[model samples]
Target: MPPAANRPRAVAIELNAVLVALIGDEPQVLTLENGALLPSGPFEGDHPTLQTGLRAWVERQTHHPLGYVEQLYTFADRSRAAATLGRRIVSISYLGLTRERAAAGEHEPGWQSWYRYFPWEDWRGGTPAVLSRQLLPRLRRWIDAAANAMTKRERRQRVEVNFADATWNEDLVLQRYELLYEAGLVPEAAARRPIADPLPGAPMHYDHRRILATGIARLRAKIKYRPVVFELMPPDFTLGQLQLAVEALAGRPLHKQNFRRLIDQQGLVEETGAVSAETGGRPARLYRFRREIVIERAVAGSKLPLSRSS
Candidate 1:
């Protein structure tokens, strides 16, 4: 084949948005004042690297210097261009972790629960009844209505992927949204016309809903293998608080006994002999994350032997 015909084309990268705010234990995600999302425009000029560009874009928009950041994923649906005034836009998404700072120079910003955008993701209390009561029914109907066998198979695959009950895999957050988008059940896709109303969970403008999923999925998966949870927590907290934070991230209740055992065995915390007056039921001792764990034993990575049997 001729070089021109065989050449791989480069995607015309455009500026996209970065969604941020402090949700749970740490400064989590921030919402845009417009009730849209907290995303930054893409690079209008050259930058040293993608991380640098993302950081600069966020600082410019929110005046919050991001601390820990990693690429989330890229969203470039063909439909994004259908209603636009120009070319197909591809948003290179990123997740940045930072504590909320004073608006650097008087740029008022909005702060909202990251979960407000995806209520279903908050499993702290338990697997949201809506998942089984509402979403699953609709999803199953969508799965059954698949016109052909291949489409049906695809739907099943996605369901198994996101709602892995045999074992709740925390990493499929974004994949779930993408699958829903593909099925046209989500608002952003063209096929979404049939389901005009939002599902039980909260919604965001345009592709922002899916973006929120991306963040949730990333954070959930990260907690298992990283101490990123501390980034959202106070320097000192009780084991109960830690469990609550993890549960919040996981969007489900955990076995409290098992959770405490896991934390104590892991040596992830150091007792301060300080009672948290903020806790009501009983005075709880406060502790701080062993600062060295991030370097020692590689944070030992968080893990809870969670079971649905409550």
Candidate 2:
């Protein structure tokens, strides 16, 4: 057996949740601390499991019940140690999907748009002006300030590939946020440098923003191979409504015809023999997700083809 001095010490565990919902085509996340942080609390010794502890705290903090919850990631970075006052703290985070619900009373934390903390991630209309007008130039300066030519080149390459000049990859949410943090262009990175403007997006307390990024990236990737997005939708929806919800989450414009074709090919949804008069142009057919696919299929994919610029 090893000596007592060589044994590793135990660390405190924490539970954080990135609960997501969509309101009128805008993707939002439940937040606490006056929208400055995600709902989180330390894991108590009496709690039977990590998930139960998480659910308890989330319900207590937000007064909202979670649905379709899944583990997002565990973070134990050295920077996070400050929050525990030199003790090691491990944050186990979860991603949850649900429809927007009204608060029972006025005192709740309430849902805030996710884009408030990630403005550059959204591209449903087109590239966010903040990217070209502010972020890209700052990123270029950051790359140029690298210690060596090779480092500069590598940084530039990563930026290009992740941002994809004319075309954007919605799945790179976490990568983009980390790049900004390293460059000290975000408010959260102000401790590293004297930030001037600090970009447009709001900053969260501690590493909550980074955790949120992880959830966003995970959801973007999962939607391509799973029908999880249905958790955020109503019982009956039109093809246009479904496409809008996807575009809102993906932060890009999707080709309408291609999107409908992909959904039809997968047979993931079925018409309800109803039409929605809410649609402006004409009454559109309503459809409901086919839950049986969960048992019958091995894996299903939701293909979202991007719309080309005119």
Candidate 3:
């Protein structure tokens, strides 16, 4: 180990925001750098707190206000330090949920579908072709390249669980991303290696993609035990619209009948005595989320019924 004085010192704190929204039937995230980066800035003493700083940066960069903000995770790996200065960089990430809005200014950051960054994670129609055709083979080679039997076996087990063919787990977003990173199949990993071809997906600057993965995994798990999905919903929406939003975030198709049953049982919404003519079907009743349920109950789980094929 190097002497204490010779060690790299913490030089900056960065606040990154993973702002998510459901637009049409796609789950979108606000991105900068032509959809290759999250909105982030250096934390300065002028802000009263970390969250305030994050809010200020996001608003200034994207020209949109944030809602339902929560701290995601902090990253301080040595490799995440400034490459040229050899100074440590601590990144504090946050997850923010909001309705989609047009960019306020000409140069504001725009929204891009999150699936563009994790193509294999989307299963709305069926299993994404990228999984078996691209990812699995590459992962198998990675597993076999392990030096020892024990290491190979452990890698295989992780791959099996995280990328299982028969069952898809929505909450494994971070695990899948990390596996790809470890296998050098992502651009971030390739940046550290001599590899040429990397898996398809828009890459972010620094570890912003990893932080987005963490936010995605957290949201997927959170919707199961809390009604936070309402934050992305409009004041009045048809059941079909609600299901589409859930499916978009979960990255899978949901059984319509079962989904409505779950929502009805939870009493999360009430009929608004209005109908939406734009549903592209027979007029569907509009419903508003019952905000009181959030206060009345300790836990209001949004039990999404996933299609087995997903």
Candidate 4:
């Protein structure tokens, strides 16, 4: 038998919350009172399954039932928290999708703009002015400070990929933040001193911002191959709302004519004979996602052509 000291110890189960809601044209995440993230509590030997536990946790806190739920990942990093003394606590993270309901006037889950946590991710107005104005210069200085040739090359590669002259790759959003963390460039890594004046985006209590980046990256990639974009849409929507959802995920505007053409060609949606007056012109027709395609293809996805201007 293996020595007792080498054997793995049983850890209490911990659940992490990743509550996302759409605001205007972007997602806002929920946070708690403590500096610690607003993740769910321990399984507490109460849950029969992870999903059941998640549903309960969300409803009890937000009073809004979750519409779509998916397990994100498990985290148990030693540096994550000072909990459990020296023991590493395993945290199961989940990506929960739901439309926000008005607060019942009681339980307060503070809503913060998701963009505040990820300023660089927004490009709906063409690369946030902040990136070109602030982040890039600091990043360049960090790049230039690399001591060796190989390190410099890696830094430049990160720069090129994260904030490249090439079209922004929506899928690499999380990877970009992680790369920054690893390079000791982000606020999370600069634990001891003030690195720069204000970071282009807001920082979270703990690793919540990083977790948000993970969700953004996952959704960006998922939308390309999984038809999950429908989760954020109304039961009926105008093509403009559809485009906005896609642009929100892609972080860039799509060509209007081409987007309509592609949606028509793919037959991913059907007109519902309903009209929305929200756009301030002739009422736009409403469309519903083709549920059949979602079931038949299961993982099928529609494409949104992205360019720098798109």
Candidate 5:
């Protein structure tokens, strides 16, 4: 350990949350200042643990209780002001799942679709137009700008695997964002010059967008094996509604027959015997997530298993 005078300066723990809710057909995150910042506050001594602190802040600010909350990542923000003040600021981030409350309009400023900040990740309809017409062309330029042949080869490989690969992996959210940030393609990057056009996505305050991506990536992966998707769903829903919720988070379309087949095989949902006609044409049967399945069975990714069958 260093001497008293040489010891590290003050450390302040900041709690940040990416409160997610499925709004309409999109996965929206609660934000402040008209959708510019994630909900965050200083960690107080009253809280016992990090997660407890995060839950408190989110619940107080949003006025909506968090259903499924998990720690995502801890980020260190070393701004000039903090350094000058002899302080180190660390943000402990969490991902909270909840349904959009009707009363959000009163307290929360905005609940914008997370895709607004990462448009390239969505492939539910098909490949996002921005990825083909914008991201790819710019990524090619960045690949070509590499200092050496070896570096160019490495960058090209990353692009191929993360972006241009024939099989698009929905969980590469953070990796995709980092590729753009490293190339100064995102506004959050501390580049010497401004990015022209900048890959066409909304930017957030500080490194909040990166934290949001971390949360999204975690969710996209978790829903594959865990029943966390139900946290974003209603008490009872149609097979179509459940599929839409999964697609909203995964950003990929799943085959109706194959997806429902997996749910049946996994015994994830039980029919509530109620039908909803909102789907149009036919009255769809509603099902509720079997809360007991969490302990009764170990779902091997079959609950949300997407074969993408034709």
Candidate 6:
């Protein structure tokens, strides 16, 4: 065995929160350091469970209480800097759903629209202009500049599937971000090569942006099969509000009729015997999510894909 000094040091654990909320027709993520980092802190022993440690960290860092929290993937390999410093950092991330409120922290924390960090991922109208005007052309150069024909073919295949002109799968948010990272098309990967024109989006500190992408991909996928989206909604909301929230997360303009039909068929929500004039010019019916339905089992997917007309 190696001497004590030569042995590997204890791993340092970090807890991070990808707190999500809907604001002004967009899905927003709670961030710190002027929207450049997710709320995170060291996992201290004052907490009993891993989750307790995470909650304390988030509340302390962002001053936002977590609701409907779930464990996100651990990023143990995020230790490039730490490794150089003779330490290992294993980040245990969590996804927390909460309503937006005024942030209270010394860290200049605020809720940033998820799309601002991933402009190409939004397809509410159609394919983002950055995809064609900026990303694909830049990616083409990266492909052509590859060392050999084999690498070029592989790059072409990934770009076609992820940023395709045909149909786009919204759940590929993390995959797309990772592809951009690999192609050095993202600011985070600028160290790999001098990105002439960095892809349109705000870059987060360290690997926090990648962690955010993972959290978003999970939420986007979870909402499709479950009522997880309701966690981010108010107790009473109009069907229109619900649909808008879903679109904001899915990043696609869902067919309204189809979305409402699926929600009804799945028995996900019901009338609260109240109407909201929140939508201008007309009163819309207010509905609350069927809380008990979650206990019984969420029956159907929200049927998120946009049809041709949408």
Q: Choose the strongest candidate by TM-score.
A: 3
lDDT of 2 at 7: 55
Residue runs of model 2 more than 4 Å from their true location after superposition: 1-10, 81-84, 102-104, 296-298
> Largest lDDT belongs to which candidate?
3
Considering lDDT, where higher is better, how would the candidates rank from best to worst? 3, 2, 6, 5, 4, 1
State which candidate, 3 or 6, has the greater lDDT: 3
Candidate 5 residues lying further than 4 Å off, grouped into runs, are 1-7, 77-85, 102-107, 190-192, 303-310
Candidate 4 weakest lDDT stretch, 10 residues:
30-39
Tens digit of per-residue lDDT, candidate 1, span 1-310:
6585465444555444444444445324665655566555666657887777877777777666777777888878766542354455677878766645545334566666666555555555566676677667778888999999999998887787786556556567777667666666655665446666546555566677777777777777777877877766777888888877776667667788888888888877889888888887888999998868567445454665666642
Clashing pairs in 2: none
Error of 3 at 118 (Å): 0.2
Question: In model 1, where do residues sit more than 4 Å from their true spots?
Answer: 1-28, 82-84, 101-107, 164-168, 190-194
Q: What is candidate 2's CA lDDT for residue 223?
A: 83
Q: Which scores higher on TM-score, 1 or 2?
A: 2
Write candidate 3's Cα lDDT for 25-89 as tens digits: 78899998888889999998999999999999998877789988999999988787374575678
Predicted structure 3: clash tally: 0
The lDDT, on a scale of 0 to 1, for candidate 3 is 0.88
Ranking by TM-score: 3, 6, 2, 5, 4, 1
Candidate 6 runs further than 4 Å off: 1-6, 103-108
The worst-scoring run of ten residues by lDDT in candidate 6 lies at 99-108
Relative to the unseen true structure, what is the C-alpha lDDT of residue 109 in candidate 2, on a scale of 0 to 100? 86
**Which pairs clash in model 3?**
none
Worst 10 residues of 2 by lDDT: 301-310
In order of listing, the candidates' clash counts read: 20, 0, 0, 2, 0, 0
